[model samples]
Target: MAIKPSKGFIYLLIVAVFVFGVPSEAHAEPSYAKYGRAAMQETANRYPDANIIDYKYEGHFETSGARNEERFRLWLRGSGGEFGVRVHVYVAADTGQVRNVELEEIAR
Candidate 1:
C-alpha cells in the first residue's frame, strides 16, 4: 500500500512555509535618506551663512490637489541670531524629482 499524507499535515506544511519564508524587511526603502538630503540642501540654500544645529522631520502633507510634500524643521545659528525654520520640499513620489522648495522662519 502507498503511504498518503493527511489534510491537516498538508495545511501545517503550507503554514510553516508562509510563516518563515517571507523576508521581514522586504518593504524597507532608502527613499527617506534621499528626502533628508534634499531637505538639508534646501535649508542650506535658504540660509547660506547659517550652521545647521538640528533638524526634525515633520511628516508628510499634501500641498495641493495634485502635489505632496515632506516637511522638516531645521534649527540654525548665524551671525545675526539663532532661530528655527520650516522647510517644505516638494518632490515627485514616483521619480523623486524635487519640484520646489519653500522656507518660513519660525518665531523664536
Candidate 2:
C-alpha cells in the first residue's frame, strides 16, 4: 500500500506559500498614526474650512504595479463623517519616511 496526499492538504500547502512564503517587503509596509500628522497639516492648509481633527496610515501596499509604488489609506475626520483617504506615499526600507500610521479610533 502507498500513502497519498489529500486534496485539502494540497490546497493548504499552496495557501501557506502565498501567506508565509513571501516577505512583506515585497508587497508593502506598515504605517503609524504620527505619519498622518503631515497630511493633516497639508489638508488644513489646502482646505481651511475643513478642520482635520485626526488622521492615520491604515496600511501600505503596491497598487497598479510594483515599481516600488504603493498607496496608504489615511483615516480622516473633519467636516465630513469618519472615512478614509488613500494617498500615494511610498517609502523605501530605510528611506526614513512614514512607514504606517495607527488608527486613533481603534488605538484603545
lDDT, residue 55, model 1: 84
Candidate 1: give the clashing pairs: none
Residue 106 in model 1: lDDT: 95
Per-prediction backbone clash count: 0, 10
| Model 1 stretches astray by more than 4 angstroms | 1-30
Task: Please report the candidate that would top TM-score against the real structure.
Answer: 1
* The 10-residue segment with the lowest total lDDT in model 1: 23-32
For each candidate, give its TM-score against the true structure.
0.65, 0.35
Location of the lowest summed lDDT over 10 successive residues in candidate 2: 99-108
* Tens digits of lDDT, candidate 2, 8-104: 9999999999889977765664443334455565445654554444444445454433223333444555565555555554444445364432222
In order, what lDDT does every prediction score?
Answer: 0.83, 0.50
